[model samples]
Target: MATKRPRRQAVSTCPCGLAETYEGCCGRFHRDEAAAPTAEALMRSRYSAFVRRDEPYLLRTWHPRTRPGRLDLDPGMRWTGLEILATTDGTPFHTTGTVTFRASFRGGTLHERSRFERVDGAWVYVDGDFPAA
Candidate 1:
Protein backbone atom coordinates (compact mmCIF):
# COMPACT_ATOMS: atom_id res chain seq x y z
CA MET A 1 0.00 0.00 0.00
CA ALA A 2 1.28 3.52 -0.84
CA THR A 3 1.38 6.00 1.99
CA LYS A 4 -0.16 9.47 1.64
CA ARG A 5 2.26 12.34 1.17
CA PRO A 6 1.99 15.74 2.72
CA ARG A 7 0.93 18.47 0.32
CA ARG A 8 3.14 21.46 -0.27
CA GLN A 9 1.57 24.80 0.55
CA ALA A 10 1.72 27.26 -2.33
CA VAL A 11 2.91 30.78 -1.61
CA SER A 12 0.72 33.37 -3.28
CA THR A 13 2.65 36.59 -2.73
CA CYS A 14 6.36 37.15 -2.97
CA PRO A 15 8.32 38.09 0.13
CA CYS A 16 9.61 41.24 -1.60
CA GLY A 17 6.17 42.89 -1.47
CA LEU A 18 5.43 42.06 -5.10
CA ALA A 19 1.92 41.01 -6.18
CA GLU A 20 3.17 38.00 -8.15
CA THR A 21 3.80 34.56 -6.70
CA TYR A 22 7.26 33.71 -5.35
CA GLU A 23 8.04 31.27 -8.15
CA GLY A 24 7.34 33.89 -10.80
CA CYS A 25 9.06 36.74 -9.00
CA CYS A 26 12.24 36.51 -6.97
CA GLY A 27 12.33 32.75 -7.13
CA ARG A 28 13.18 32.91 -10.80
CA PHE A 29 16.14 35.17 -10.09
CA HIS A 30 17.17 33.03 -7.15
CA ARG A 31 17.14 29.97 -9.39
CA ASP A 32 19.46 31.75 -11.88
CA GLU A 33 16.83 31.52 -14.61
CA ALA A 34 17.17 35.26 -15.20
CA ALA A 35 19.17 38.26 -14.06
CA ALA A 36 17.64 41.37 -12.54
CA PRO A 37 17.46 44.02 -15.25
CA THR A 38 17.49 47.01 -12.92
CA ALA A 39 19.13 47.90 -9.66
CA GLU A 40 15.79 48.03 -7.87
CA ALA A 41 15.00 44.56 -9.15
CA LEU A 42 18.31 43.29 -7.83
CA MET A 43 17.65 44.98 -4.50
CA ARG A 44 14.23 43.37 -4.26
CA SER A 45 15.66 39.96 -5.11
CA ARG A 46 18.39 40.40 -2.47
CA TYR A 47 15.75 41.20 0.12
CA SER A 48 13.88 38.05 -0.82
CA ALA A 49 17.13 36.13 -0.53
CA PHE A 50 17.59 37.38 3.01
CA VAL A 51 14.02 36.42 3.86
CA ARG A 52 14.59 32.92 2.51
CA ARG A 53 18.14 32.65 3.95
CA ASP A 54 19.59 32.08 0.51
CA GLU A 55 23.20 32.97 1.26
CA PRO A 56 24.63 31.66 -1.98
CA TYR A 57 22.34 33.84 -4.05
CA LEU A 58 23.28 36.81 -1.94
CA LEU A 59 26.99 36.19 -2.36
CA ARG A 60 26.68 35.44 -6.04
CA THR A 61 24.94 38.74 -6.70
CA TRP A 62 27.38 40.81 -4.65
CA HIS A 63 30.18 42.74 -6.25
CA PRO A 64 33.45 40.89 -6.09
CA ARG A 65 35.26 43.90 -4.70
CA THR A 66 32.86 44.05 -1.78
CA ARG A 67 31.56 40.51 -1.54
CA PRO A 68 32.24 38.87 1.79
CA GLY A 69 33.82 35.49 2.13
CA ARG A 70 30.68 34.09 3.71
CA LEU A 71 27.34 35.05 5.18
CA ASP A 72 26.20 34.41 8.74
CA LEU A 73 22.42 34.58 8.74
CA ASP A 74 20.66 34.23 12.04
CA PRO A 75 18.38 31.20 12.05
CA GLY A 76 16.13 32.75 14.67
CA MET A 77 15.47 35.93 12.77
CA ARG A 78 12.02 36.15 11.17
CA TRP A 79 11.74 38.59 8.28
CA THR A 80 8.39 40.34 8.05
CA GLY A 81 8.40 42.67 5.04
CA LEU A 82 10.34 44.86 2.60
CA GLU A 83 9.54 48.44 1.61
CA ILE A 84 11.42 50.35 -1.07
CA LEU A 85 11.46 54.06 -0.42
CA ALA A 86 13.55 55.43 -3.29
CA THR A 87 15.74 54.55 -6.25
CA THR A 88 18.39 56.52 -8.12
CA ASP A 89 19.74 55.54 -11.51
CA GLY A 90 20.25 51.78 -11.42
CA THR A 91 18.31 51.21 -14.60
CA PRO A 92 19.57 49.43 -17.71
CA PHE A 93 20.87 52.67 -19.11
CA HIS A 94 23.01 53.42 -16.05
CA THR A 95 26.04 51.55 -14.81
CA THR A 96 25.38 52.28 -11.13
CA GLY A 97 22.38 52.86 -8.87
CA THR A 98 21.12 53.16 -5.35
CA VAL A 99 18.04 51.72 -3.64
CA THR A 100 16.86 52.99 -0.30
CA PHE A 101 14.65 50.55 1.55
CA ARG A 102 13.34 49.32 4.85
CA ALA A 103 13.40 45.66 5.73
CA SER A 104 11.34 44.69 8.75
CA PHE A 105 11.91 41.69 10.92
CA ARG A 106 9.99 40.33 13.89
CA GLY A 107 11.47 42.89 16.27
CA GLY A 108 12.58 45.91 14.27
CA THR A 109 13.18 47.47 10.87
CA LEU A 110 16.46 48.05 9.04
CA HIS A 111 16.73 51.11 6.83
CA GLU A 112 19.51 51.38 4.29
CA ARG A 113 20.56 52.95 1.03
CA SER A 114 22.14 50.17 -0.95
CA ARG A 115 24.45 50.62 -3.92
CA PHE A 116 24.55 48.56 -7.10
CA GLU A 117 26.67 48.37 -10.20
CA ARG A 118 26.77 46.51 -13.48
CA VAL A 119 29.47 43.90 -13.91
CA ASP A 120 29.61 42.03 -17.18
CA GLY A 121 26.15 43.37 -18.05
CA ALA A 122 24.59 42.04 -14.86
CA TRP A 123 23.44 44.05 -11.88
CA VAL A 124 25.36 43.28 -8.71
CA TYR A 125 25.13 44.63 -5.17
CA VAL A 126 28.07 46.63 -3.89
CA ASP A 127 27.40 48.01 -0.40
CA GLY A 128 24.96 49.94 1.73
CA ASP A 129 24.83 52.80 4.19
CA PHE A 130 22.59 52.98 7.26
CA PRO A 131 21.16 56.38 7.92
CA ALA A 132 21.32 57.84 11.40
CA ALA A 133 18.08 57.51 13.37
Candidate 2:
Protein backbone atom coordinates (compact mmCIF):
# COMPACT_ATOMS: atom_id res chain seq x y z
CA MET A 1 0.00 0.00 0.00
CA ALA A 2 1.10 3.56 -0.63
CA THR A 3 0.93 6.33 1.93
CA LYS A 4 -0.99 9.47 1.12
CA ARG A 5 0.60 12.76 1.92
CA PRO A 6 -1.08 15.34 4.13
CA ARG A 7 -2.36 18.48 2.53
CA ARG A 8 -0.12 21.50 2.59
CA GLN A 9 -1.02 24.20 5.07
CA ALA A 10 -2.12 27.46 3.52
CA VAL A 11 0.24 30.38 3.53
CA SER A 12 -0.41 33.87 4.88
CA THR A 13 -0.24 35.98 1.72
CA CYS A 14 -0.78 35.28 -1.95
CA PRO A 15 2.17 35.79 -4.27
CA CYS A 16 -0.09 36.79 -7.17
CA GLY A 17 0.06 40.47 -6.08
CA LEU A 18 -3.46 40.13 -4.66
CA ALA A 19 -4.48 41.48 -1.27
CA GLU A 20 -6.20 38.28 -0.14
CA THR A 21 -4.49 35.58 1.84
CA TYR A 22 -3.29 32.62 -0.19
CA GLU A 23 -6.17 30.37 0.85
CA GLY A 24 -8.78 33.02 0.11
CA CYS A 25 -7.22 33.85 -3.24
CA CYS A 26 -5.27 31.73 -5.70
CA GLY A 27 -5.20 28.66 -3.47
CA ARG A 28 -8.79 27.83 -4.35
CA PHE A 29 -7.95 27.67 -8.04
CA HIS A 30 -4.72 25.79 -7.41
CA ARG A 31 -6.65 23.16 -5.50
CA ASP A 32 -9.32 22.93 -8.20
CA GLU A 33 -11.96 24.16 -5.78
CA ALA A 34 -12.95 26.88 -8.24
CA ALA A 35 -12.21 27.91 -11.81
CA ALA A 36 -10.81 31.36 -12.47
CA PRO A 37 -13.69 33.56 -13.61
CA THR A 38 -11.69 35.70 -16.04
CA ALA A 39 -8.58 35.67 -18.13
CA GLU A 40 -6.79 38.07 -15.84
CA ALA A 41 -7.78 35.98 -12.83
CA LEU A 42 -6.43 32.87 -14.48
CA MET A 43 -3.26 34.71 -15.36
CA ARG A 44 -2.87 35.81 -11.76
CA SER A 45 -3.40 32.28 -10.48
CA ARG A 46 -0.81 30.98 -12.96
CA TYR A 47 1.67 33.53 -11.70
CA SER A 48 0.98 32.39 -8.16
CA ALA A 49 1.50 28.81 -9.29
CA PHE A 50 4.94 29.71 -10.57
CA VAL A 51 5.78 31.44 -7.33
CA ARG A 52 4.68 28.40 -5.32
CA ARG A 53 6.34 26.08 -7.87
CA ASP A 54 3.07 24.26 -8.34
CA GLU A 55 3.94 22.52 -11.60
CA PRO A 56 0.85 20.30 -11.55
CA TYR A 57 -1.47 23.28 -11.33
CA LEU A 58 0.38 24.94 -14.20
CA LEU A 59 0.06 21.84 -16.35
CA ARG A 60 -3.59 21.30 -15.51
CA THR A 61 -4.59 24.83 -16.47
CA TRP A 62 -2.60 24.78 -19.72
CA HIS A 63 -4.35 24.38 -23.06
CA PRO A 64 -3.91 20.95 -24.58
CA ARG A 65 -2.44 22.35 -27.77
CA THR A 66 0.18 24.35 -25.95
CA ARG A 67 0.76 22.44 -22.74
CA PRO A 68 4.23 20.97 -22.58
CA GLY A 69 4.81 17.40 -21.56
CA ARG A 70 6.38 18.63 -18.33
CA LEU A 71 7.79 21.66 -16.67
CA ASP A 72 11.38 22.30 -15.64
CA LEU A 73 11.08 24.97 -13.02
CA ASP A 74 14.19 26.28 -11.41
CA PRO A 75 14.06 25.39 -7.74
CA GLY A 76 16.43 28.21 -6.97
CA MET A 77 14.69 30.91 -8.93
CA ARG A 78 13.03 33.43 -6.64
CA TRP A 79 9.79 34.95 -7.92
CA THR A 80 9.30 38.37 -6.40
CA GLY A 81 6.02 39.90 -7.59
CA LEU A 82 3.57 40.46 -10.45
CA GLU A 83 2.04 43.48 -12.15
CA ILE A 84 -1.05 43.23 -14.37
CA LEU A 85 -0.68 45.82 -17.08
CA ALA A 86 -3.65 45.11 -19.38
CA THR A 87 -6.41 42.73 -20.39
CA THR A 88 -8.73 42.11 -23.33
CA ASP A 89 -12.03 40.26 -23.68
CA GLY A 90 -11.31 37.77 -20.93
CA THR A 91 -14.63 37.65 -19.16
CA PRO A 92 -17.33 35.09 -18.45
CA PHE A 93 -19.17 36.30 -21.54
CA HIS A 94 -16.13 35.83 -23.77
CA THR A 95 -14.57 32.55 -24.84
CA THR A 96 -11.13 34.00 -25.53
CA GLY A 97 -8.97 36.57 -23.83
CA THR A 98 -5.52 38.03 -23.31
CA VAL A 99 -3.59 39.28 -20.30
CA THR A 100 -0.48 41.42 -20.36
CA PHE A 101 1.71 41.55 -17.29
CA ARG A 102 5.16 41.75 -15.81
CA ALA A 103 6.42 39.12 -13.42
CA SER A 104 9.48 40.06 -11.43
CA PHE A 105 11.96 37.64 -10.09
CA ARG A 106 15.09 38.11 -8.04
CA GLY A 107 17.25 39.12 -10.99
CA GLY A 108 14.83 40.58 -13.56
CA THR A 109 11.30 40.90 -14.91
CA LEU A 110 9.31 38.94 -17.47
CA HIS A 111 6.93 40.95 -19.61
CA GLU A 112 4.41 38.98 -21.59
CA ARG A 113 1.08 39.12 -23.34
CA SER A 114 -0.53 35.76 -22.67
CA ARG A 115 -3.35 34.28 -24.71
CA PHE A 116 -6.08 32.09 -23.27
CA GLU A 117 -9.04 30.06 -24.49
CA ARG A 118 -12.06 28.29 -23.03
CA VAL A 119 -11.79 24.51 -23.20
CA ASP A 120 -14.79 22.48 -22.09
CA GLY A 121 -16.09 25.52 -20.22
CA ALA A 122 -12.80 26.16 -18.40
CA TRP A 123 -10.11 28.68 -19.15
CA VAL A 124 -6.73 27.31 -20.18
CA TYR A 125 -3.46 28.97 -21.01
CA VAL A 126 -2.67 28.84 -24.73
CA ASP A 127 0.71 30.57 -24.99
CA GLY A 128 2.42 33.92 -24.55
CA ASP A 129 4.58 36.41 -26.38
CA PHE A 130 7.42 38.28 -24.76
CA PRO A 131 7.12 41.93 -25.55
CA ALA A 132 10.13 43.85 -26.73
CA ALA A 133 12.04 45.77 -24.12
Candidate 3:
Protein backbone atom coordinates (compact mmCIF):
# COMPACT_ATOMS: atom_id res chain seq x y z
CA MET A 1 0.00 0.00 0.00
CA ALA A 2 1.19 3.53 -0.76
CA THR A 3 1.44 6.07 2.04
CA LYS A 4 -0.73 9.16 1.83
CA ARG A 5 0.90 12.58 1.85
CA PRO A 6 -0.56 15.50 3.73
CA ARG A 7 -1.87 18.38 1.67
CA ARG A 8 -0.12 21.75 1.91
CA GLN A 9 -2.19 24.41 3.59
CA ALA A 10 -2.49 27.93 2.24
CA VAL A 11 -0.58 30.70 3.98
CA SER A 12 -2.73 33.06 5.99
CA THR A 13 -0.12 35.28 7.58
CA CYS A 14 1.00 38.43 5.86
CA PRO A 15 4.49 38.19 4.42
CA CYS A 16 5.35 41.60 5.83
CA GLY A 17 4.99 40.15 9.37
CA LEU A 18 2.83 43.02 10.58
CA ALA A 19 -0.66 41.63 10.08
CA GLU A 20 -2.46 38.53 11.30
CA THR A 21 -3.55 37.55 7.80
CA TYR A 22 -2.83 38.44 4.22
CA GLU A 23 -6.37 39.61 3.54
CA GLY A 24 -6.36 42.06 6.45
CA CYS A 25 -3.03 43.43 5.34
CA CYS A 26 -1.18 43.36 2.02
CA GLY A 27 -3.90 41.46 0.24
CA ARG A 28 -6.14 44.51 0.46
CA PHE A 29 -3.62 46.56 -1.45
CA HIS A 30 -2.82 43.77 -3.91
CA ARG A 31 -6.49 43.29 -4.67
CA ASP A 32 -7.08 47.01 -5.27
CA GLU A 33 -9.41 47.27 -2.33
CA ALA A 34 -7.24 49.93 -0.67
CA ALA A 35 -4.10 51.96 -1.10
CA ALA A 36 -1.26 52.12 1.38
CA PRO A 37 -1.68 55.21 3.54
CA THR A 38 1.95 55.54 4.51
CA ALA A 39 5.44 54.75 3.35
CA GLU A 40 5.79 51.92 5.85
CA ALA A 41 2.57 50.39 4.63
CA LEU A 42 3.73 50.60 1.04
CA MET A 43 7.05 49.02 1.97
CA ARG A 44 5.30 46.20 3.76
CA SER A 45 2.98 45.64 0.82
CA ARG A 46 5.96 45.58 -1.55
CA TYR A 47 7.57 42.89 0.58
CA SER A 48 4.38 40.90 0.44
CA ALA A 49 4.36 41.31 -3.34
CA PHE A 50 7.84 39.79 -3.50
CA VAL A 51 6.64 36.81 -1.51
CA ARG A 52 3.67 36.36 -3.81
CA ARG A 53 5.73 37.03 -6.95
CA ASP A 54 3.26 39.73 -7.96
CA GLU A 55 5.46 41.68 -10.32
CA PRO A 56 2.60 43.83 -11.58
CA TYR A 57 1.74 45.05 -8.11
CA LEU A 58 5.37 45.85 -7.43
CA LEU A 59 5.71 47.78 -10.65
CA ARG A 60 2.44 49.63 -10.14
CA THR A 61 3.56 50.90 -6.74
CA TRP A 62 7.05 51.84 -7.83
CA HIS A 63 7.84 55.43 -8.78
CA PRO A 64 8.01 55.83 -12.51
CA ARG A 65 11.35 57.63 -12.36
CA THR A 66 13.16 54.66 -10.91
CA ARG A 67 10.81 51.81 -11.72
CA PRO A 68 12.10 49.22 -14.13
CA GLY A 69 10.16 48.46 -17.27
CA ARG A 70 10.12 44.81 -16.28
CA LEU A 71 10.83 42.86 -13.10
CA ASP A 72 12.58 39.50 -13.22
CA LEU A 73 11.99 37.77 -9.92
CA ASP A 74 14.21 34.83 -9.10
CA PRO A 75 12.25 31.59 -8.86
CA GLY A 76 14.69 30.19 -6.32
CA MET A 77 14.31 33.11 -3.95
CA ARG A 78 11.87 32.67 -1.10
CA TRP A 79 11.12 35.51 1.30
CA THR A 80 10.90 34.34 4.89
CA GLY A 81 10.40 37.47 7.02
CA LEU A 82 10.49 41.26 7.37
CA GLU A 83 11.64 43.57 10.16
CA ILE A 84 11.07 47.32 10.05
CA LEU A 85 13.77 49.25 11.90
CA ALA A 86 12.82 52.90 11.44
CA THR A 87 10.68 55.42 9.55
CA THR A 88 11.10 59.12 8.77
CA ASP A 89 8.61 61.72 7.57
CA GLY A 90 6.17 59.28 5.95
CA THR A 91 3.03 60.96 7.17
CA PRO A 92 0.13 62.06 5.02
CA PHE A 93 1.43 65.63 5.16
CA HIS A 94 4.85 64.63 3.99
CA THR A 95 5.80 64.36 0.31
CA THR A 96 8.96 62.31 0.79
CA GLY A 97 9.91 59.65 3.32
CA THR A 98 12.24 56.84 4.19
CA VAL A 99 11.82 53.39 5.71
CA THR A 100 14.64 51.22 6.98
CA PHE A 101 14.06 47.49 7.19
CA ARG A 102 15.49 44.01 7.00
CA ALA A 103 13.94 41.40 4.70
CA SER A 104 15.01 37.81 5.24
CA PHE A 105 15.05 35.34 2.36
CA ARG A 106 15.79 31.63 2.16
CA GLY A 107 19.56 31.94 2.31
CA GLY A 108 20.24 35.63 3.08
CA THR A 109 18.92 38.88 4.49
CA LEU A 110 18.64 42.34 2.92
CA HIS A 111 18.97 45.47 5.00
CA GLU A 112 17.92 48.63 3.24
CA ARG A 113 16.80 52.19 3.78
CA SER A 114 14.14 52.79 1.18
CA ARG A 115 12.90 56.12 -0.10
CA PHE A 116 9.32 56.94 -1.01
CA GLU A 117 7.38 59.86 -2.36
CA ARG A 118 3.75 60.84 -2.52
CA VAL A 119 2.65 61.28 -6.11
CA ASP A 120 -0.96 62.26 -6.82
CA GLY A 121 -1.72 61.50 -3.17
CA ALA A 122 -0.38 57.95 -3.48
CA TRP A 123 2.80 56.66 -1.93
CA VAL A 124 5.31 55.15 -4.34
CA TYR A 125 8.70 53.53 -3.83
CA VAL A 126 11.54 55.53 -5.34
CA ASP A 127 14.75 53.73 -4.46
CA GLY A 128 16.66 51.94 -1.69
CA ASP A 129 20.16 51.83 -0.31
CA PHE A 130 21.57 48.68 1.23
CA PRO A 131 23.46 48.86 4.48
CA ALA A 132 27.00 47.57 4.68
CA ALA A 133 27.06 43.85 5.33
- C-alpha local distance difference test of each model: 0.96, 0.95, 0.94
- Candidate 1: global Cα-lDDT? 0.96
lDDT of 2 at 70: 100
Q: List the residue pairs that clash in candidate 1.
A: none
Global fold similarity of model 2 (TM-score) = 0.90
| Inter-residue clash pairs, candidate 2 | none
Question: Could you give candidate 2's per-residue lDDT for residues 44-115 as a string of tens digits?
Answer: 999999999999999999999989999999999999999999999999999999999999999999999999
Question: Cα deviation in Å at residue 128, candidate 3?
Answer: 0.8
The list of candidate 3 runs beyond 4 A from truth reads 1-11
Residue 63 shift from truth in candidate 2, angstroms = 0.3
Q: Alpha carbon lDDT of residue 52, candidate 2? A: 91
Best by lDDT: 1
1-133 in candidate 1: lDDT tens per residue?
9999999987679999989999999999999999999999999999999999999999999999999999999999999999999999999999999999999999999999999999999999999999875
Q: What is the C-alpha RMSD of each candidate to the true structure, in Å?
A: 3.8, 7.6, 4.1
lDDT of 3: 0.94
Better of 2 and 3 by lDDT: 2
